[model samples]
Target: MMLANVGTADRIIRIIIGLAIIAWSISAENLWWILGAVVLATGVFKFCGLYKVLGISTQGSTSK
Candidate 1:
């Protein structure tokens, strides 16, 4: 199963930041676009491999 480690607010912020990075990358025609794409993807999917590696999850638990 794909665990959703990103919360709604975090995802929204990521998407905004990612889009800004992408816009800058496009204007500069640099490799930063790749980073932006990855951020956007992680936001969209609500899963972050880095978060997994770091044992960090923004999602609230439902263990009740």
Candidate 2:
């Protein structure tokens, strides 16, 4: 299983931004929703592939 690299605050922000983008996409009929979905997935999963690749972790050491 992949470790969580996203912190709580980061997750919350991503979720909010993702939802907003998705909402806008639904209203605008654009493809930006795909990006939103990706962002949402990262937030929901609490793991970011890019963060993994970059060796970054916003999660606190207590969780690890």
Candidate 3:
């Protein structure tokens, strides 16, 4: 299983951005929704594969 690399703030921002992208994509009839779904998944799961690979973690010591 992947570790939690996304912090609270990052998660919130990702969720909002993901939703916006998804909504816009639907209206525009584009394929950006796929990217939006990935962003949303990372936020909802609190884990980021890229962050892990890049040795980046937004999570604070106080968080789980």
lDDT for residue 4 in candidate 1, whole number 0-100: 95
Better of 2 and 3 by lDDT: 2
Q: Model 2 over residues 1-64: C-alpha lDDT tens digits?
A: 9988999999999999999999999999999999999999999999999999999999989732
lDDT for 38 (candidate 2):
97
TM-score preference between candidates 2 and 3, better one:
2
Quantify all predictions' global Cα lDDT against the true fold: 0.93, 0.96, 0.95
User: Would you give me the overall lDDT of model 3?
Assistant: 0.95
lDDT of 3 at 8: 97
lDDT of 2: 0.96
Off by over 4 Å in 2: none
Whose lDDT is higher: candidate 1's or candidate 2's?
2
lDDT of 3 by residue, 11-34 (tens): 999999999999999999999999
Among residues 3 or more apart in sequence or in different chains, the pairs in candidate 2 whose N, CA or C atoms overlap within 3 Å are none
Rank the models by TM-score, top first.
2, 3, 1
Name the better of 1 and 3 by lDDT: 3
TM-score of 1: 0.91
Task: Put the candidates in lDDT order, highest first.
Answer: 2, 3, 1
> What TM-score does candidate 3 reach?
0.93
The residue pairs that clash in candidate 1, if any, are none
What's the TM-score of each model vs. the native? 0.91, 0.94, 0.93
